[model samples]
Target: MNWYQTWNNPLKNLLWWLVIIGMLGSLPLAYMRHETETSTKNVEFVFDYRDLLDIADLQTNPQKFVQDQLGKMKAAGIGSMAVYESTLAEFKESRRIDLYNSRDAAALTQTFGDPSENFTYLLFTNNEAQQKLEPLIQKTFADLGVGVKPWSFKNRSGLVIQMSPDDAAIKAMDPDPIAMQMLKDQGFQLVVRLSNHREFKSNDMDRLLKQLHDLGVKRIIVDGNEVPGYTEENTEENLNKMADLLNKYGMGLAAIELLKEPQKGFSTLAKQTNYNVVRLHSFTEKDGDKLTEPLKKSELEGRIQGVADRFVLAVKDRNIRMVFINGHAVKSLDRAKVVDPLSAYYESLTGTDGAIPRIEKFGFDLGPAQPFEVHTTSWQKVARVFLLIGGLSLVVLMLSFFIPEGTLIFFVLGLIGLVGVHVLSANLYAQGLALMTAISAPSVAVMLAIRTVRSGASAKWKSGIGFGLWLLLRTSLISLIGIVYEVALLNHITYSLVLQQFRGVGLLHLLPIAIAGLYLLFFSENNTYSEKLANIRRILSSYISVLWIVIAGVGLAAVYYYLSRTGNEGQASTVEKLFRSYLENTMGVRPRTKEFLVAHPIFVLGGYLAVRYRHAVYLLFIGVVGQLSLVDTFAHLHTPLHISLLRIFYGLVIGAILGLILCAAWEIVARSWKRWAKPQLLK
Candidate 1:
């Protein structure tokens, strides 16, 4: 006789389907909002390819690693890569035991400078140190099979060796000419690093230009520690002459300046050239004691504005095509700052356009399982969708058979299905299927929530807004976990380092949630709204000792907060910056937004409700949203680090403490209200 059990109610079934539609609509809205802000700036990302270029990284399937990194760049729409140009160190070391056999260390140092001001002490004492260092050094070389032999690695660009006698010899290092050709052949622009200051001498200009032109190299990153053979006073004049020579060769010059004050030299150079890229290099110098302090937004913004004042506007006025804000992110937080609003502001000033990588347009075939294949399809094409619905429906009904009386099977089912689909959707067809799930799962949740609320046999079902929201919150948390895992795990992406392919939940990810909804609506126990709340309340209060329970929950939250961001000092600093940026984006200066007005209130209310009414799910739902946003915030791999780690601690621990306080406070109010009032709201 119950309404949920009645097979005759056609109206209730239709109502169930309507809520499902609303759920699907939220995704694309979320996706479009995060994809790109409308802008006209021609901003392109220039990533340092060191992690991919290490001698060790090269040996462990270099091609695959290249492909992986390439896929990441393509996904992020990266404009160019800064590649390391080897000097004749390998060639020099081939016949000698000394570091200086091939390298003009003093001459090179004049331009590029010692890596640090104090490196001279180490370098000058090398002869004395050699006696002590020789055995260990020789053992290392021998272990790596480098006895009196020039060492090199192969790639699409050919053989890149550690030692080459001269600039001309460097070209011969390319082994896979065809593979190396792929970089130029596929429209991948290059920004080669200039070795020492000598590479930019006026006399050597022609040779450098000819070689670069031949290799299709267009840009050069000048590491002018002090401009070799030229006084610091001639920096502007020399740069102007170099720019003119490069322009004649149809090449561009990039000047990288440290993130310091009075960038007069670089700013003067910017005012002089139109065919150029200027980078404000911000990095943590280990020796100079850089990035040791926590970053502040106001300070960072001031620095960005300083650079903007110096060159961002000038670069734009001159219509320069690219600008790089190059900073090394050795830590998670540092990486986050690298991609924050300050960086975005630079791009906004410059412009953003055509950053989507042309993966298929890449001239070389990167094998069949290429990660960049597009996966959309026309609606009329696939008739299997109807069959898929039936199949999923059947599976859900079957899966529901095993869930216990009180457990929410929908959450479990949805997580498994989405996680599996996300993991398994490797090919085109499966990708399409995954997309379908994303669109369909929201509607399914609406339907499930409505059906559960309309349980008893009646002419009209009860309004289930509260119950529906509870379902939404629960499934959303689970879905978030599954989707975050899929995107982060599949791409092997970390802190936007490897780059992520997708930034939002897709059909493949939604399939599991949809299946779980079906199980919850039709086959599960008929636990009503009152029953669910009572059970939840019991678990929070009388089910166990409240003080012990609060401590445990708070402890777990604190641990999750710490482990996720703390470990290595660099990592901790990095994560701190990352989380701070995330907070600023979500909670900063937003008085009317849902995150500020609703979820945060719900989070507090849920805590109070849990203490007073024993409803823990509501509080948990809000926390998970914050946690998930944390994932999706950095999910856009281009989002570099720039926040403090303490914000995360405040969010998790303080929120937990506040909840405990609210719970106690709510309990006191409920008791007073019951004692004084005729009609009670607490019960």
Candidate 2:
């Protein structure tokens, strides 16, 4: 089953031409993506104002601390402040008003507690506070059907509500107007935060948004699990209403990255707003603790470096333009003082080797982040069809390796199936085709490498090295074609922002390796098709041994471990993390560890060894890891195209270097065994 001979059939030849044409056609889509990504050059760092206030409250002078921190943050390159929906507790902390629970109010006024009911009390701290917050408080409790009445204390205005202080504290309200004005006065941009915790009242929310619009707020980051105004049954209508308000006010949404799941109604809201969205990365309190909790200077520095690296990756690799940095206060036992992470946060952004400079070096400016301005062309439809054809043909070509006669049949069925999927859901069609290309491309590349190795055996070490390097380059190119096809087919902006994603990632990681192994087992030998089938039967029927069974168990464990470490959330050893940091710092883009360290070296060694030992063909199964990873790299649509290309390039160069070293070592070991060890054994 010579691969070249298989392509001698007209059908296979036609399929190859289709794939080539598809690759050529998809160039425009990739170009479009390049333009879109390059168009967005502004990155914004936003400090969480609520978190700041929470932290500030822990300081001796809350107001002075906030003012001082804001000045420092502005100096440290923070340009915006994110304000969350307000609560009574927050207002009390900010000193906009004085709030008192039933017991406290009773103690302060020298009155007995109410016999059966508890009521919350609020007192305006100043005339300005009274003028601004009086109507808001009255209307807020009035709408909830909770009793509200006027009160006076020391000639200052206040309100009494017929709810327990605890019950009153949790009620969501508008973001504090005073804080918005103060932040605006400080020359900070406002990123209003919203949540779906309150009852959905379209008119009320409209007024709130209109007020935020007047305050010069430009973006909103939704809190909790749902977008503001989202409702279960009337989700569409609610999102449409929210989208209309956002559009009317000229404000966009920031889609937070790495959420447990996407916020509900976000995709719909984004679509309705004509995709007015930017990717946002949030540095949570947990992340802050990693940097500030460590008392040792070296440990703290390393943690800060890790966070800084994430910021750089977010801005440059992922299309994250907005970063939300949280703050927290920690009680330090050794220092006997309350400490805040504000200084460490500043260091993360503006230290000597901080995220700000690194991101700016990568061509981003400090400004308000803008949504990607995606420009669509009429020709993209035709280009997508070509990409679809290319993917289907690639799939058919892979199938032809095992079922050579079914090339035309598989193509026809694939075409029909894709059409059906497209008619039902375009996203499904794109994701399905992308997965097919992902699997088929690597399988085909590995199979072709095997064919090339089998065609000639280079006994000389130098020839083996050259042959292996050549095969590596050729196979990588073949895998890259799959990337082109995937990029073209799933070129929707949704994927770029991760509002939608390329599905079947786990399958993409595993299938090609399995396919390559099966192909090697069945077809690597020069035997008739029936003989190959008989050999498989004989092997399956062979008697088992305990030692072999133990080896298989270990092999399965290795496979399980390999799969566990494939995705973004994969666990890595501390040593590996340090090594990765070194690589990233040295290279500016860290090539994946598995690619350079494991897959690529194995591939290079496999190519060299296949010529010397027939059994070495099994190494191609491992080699398929690198090939598939190259293709899978592009499946992460959120990663910028150029970054993925750079990563792949680095992986190849470094992997090839390491592979050559392994080949040289093998040669040394073999020579030693033949000259000394083998002769002694023969005696």
Candidate 3:
């Protein structure tokens, strides 16, 4: 019969259309249900654009900036804010600019910069109060003459900032001598040094220390050099001696002079001796060379924040309490010292005058901050729907057997409809359990019905057996094809590269083919006692193929593990290295290949022998092993090349072997059946 003739059979055509249409319609509903169910339970509020604001800049316009930020918070339904600062010098020194330049506006808003120029403000209220705050904050910013634009909004978490100090003006303010004296009088440790001019004699150092002591200054930082015209070595020795003298005097030493090179060794010594603070000199010529023109505020914040986080971690590790952050390299050590430009910029962007729409349009409210609440469906509802669909499919399957011949088409249609429902359930709800239950229950029912309908009469029994066998073979082939398709698709140059390139996602693409294999196995027929025994023998033979592939996988894993652990390249050949690399990159876990081979040599050898003989059971075993390895490998590894190549090779090898095996098995079964029938005929 032509393909069209078979497919166009009125009953078959109807079943096919029913199956296709049902599956197509159900998927979207299932996906929707799944998403709704998953989302309802844990509603988290994420900040929309966090990095856009630089806290350091907020010091320039604290009130206006904060009010503007408050407006965004009101719109987004954000309740709380956390603020941190990064040093200016680090910001200029780092690659934050590149990062900012590469990112889109949305990404640009996630990080904040230099806390010294900013202070965090959080708005708290019930949902109603929050709704009122957005417009109010916007108007407030407009009244202050700060151009407010909407930057981004979040439903739950948001950040805001306030004022910063002026750098140049603060730099001009010198320490008051009386104020210094008063601090000394209060028994506080005080260190004073000239901002410039490094040269000093040992006698000069002594006079300075003595003068400070007379003034009740308990601690002093002086030029490290003890004598003018001293050699570098002498200068170094003098500095060390001066440090020791300070310790002896029960005082702290702060080095005012910059070391020619910042030595890790000297830093270690200074740390050990509690020299507490070591000030770096002006930015080196090399540093100046590295600085780029037109420093972006976003880039500056990222670099600054990175340094701050690192410094915090380092200081915490060392148990250090106070560290002086220089204005030149570290920016502001205290928030009261510098303006945060980025924060002001962010406020301006997120203000009422901003280009972006109000937060409500984006499914959020801004103002009095409140806990986020997202609309979603309950899992119980999803479960009930699934149960209803499954029960209906089961009922249809049971009715198929007891019904008349003409009604078979209706039963088939119902089965197809159930399959459609399963697909729909999967797509809409993403509930694998529901879909599986729906699909499997109907399949089981159909098998049972077929078994029952064929049991009454001899002719009917013969026809049923033949049809069952054909169905088994068809299902098995289809399942094998699905497996091969999956494996072939996976074969690529690099699994990671493949994953990186993946953009399209279709509903049918996501289903696991292994489930199809299981379905085929469950529906397969073994009628007579001899036929059942033959099936068992075939299954046993298939184990041999599985054994061979398992041995290979284990062997490859062992070599990879040994190579990786020992870092010994010489032990493995190029081919072995390639294979090992593929396995390791494809499968995160390394298997013990050598050990497995040693442990199961008999099984491995038998499986290999069966493959050589083109045994169908062995081929099936090989395919299963390959499928399992591919699945496990894909699950663990990020690289696609290894996965793809391994899958393709596995499929091709297993498919070829299995095809031959099936042909041989069919021939053998046919011959045996014929011989048995002939004896019965002779009788």
For lDDT, the strongest prediction is 2
Better of 2 and 3 by lDDT: 2
**What lDDT tens digits, residue by residue, belong to model 2 across residues 303-400?**
77788898998888889999999868888786888877888888888896999999988889999999998967778878878887888999998998
Off by over 4 Å in 1: 1-40, 55-76, 90-182, 213-218, 227-237, 249-265, 274-683
What lDDT score is found at residue 463 in candidate 1?
A: 25
Tens-place lDDT per residue, model 1, 1-683, is 45433432442343224323332322332233223211113444455544334421324464565566555555444546655543223222221122331334445334453343221011212233334333433333344343332221121111112322242233212112232345666566666655443434575556555666787666665544432223456665677776566667666445443233332343333334452433323222231123223458665444443333323222222222344433322323745432212233333233332112221121211211101111222321232332233223322322333332312344345446755664666333333333343333333333333333344221132422233234435434433322322222222211111211343342222333344444443333466656766755765586456897898899679646534532122134555445543443344311212233333345545533432232343243443334333233323332211221223333444444444455567668878877877365554
Where model 3 places Cα greater than 4 Å from the true spot, the runs are 1-54, 57-435, 438-515, 518-530, 541-547, 550-683
lDDT to native, each model: 0.37, 0.86, 0.34
Worst 10 residues of 3 by lDDT: 40-49
Across residues 1-683, which tens digit of lDDT does each residue of candidate 3 receive?
Answer: 45544433454335334433433334343334223222211111112111223332334563355356545543532332211112212122121111112123234456654433332222322343234333433443344343433332355322231312122111211223333453344333444442213243455446545655565444333323322223455555655565555455545433322244332223432433453332212222223222222357775544333333322322222111222222111244443344333332233224332212222232323221111122223443443443334333333332332332333454556557756755775333223323332333323322332333233221233332243234333323323322222222222212211111222221122222233233234323435546656766787687557889899799779545534433112265666655654553344223323212221222222233332232322222223232222322322212222333444444443443444454456557768979897789888
Whichever of 2 and 3 has more TM-score, that candidate is: 2
* Best-to-worst TM-score order: 2, 1, 3
Q: Output the lDDT of residue 93, model 2.
A: 89
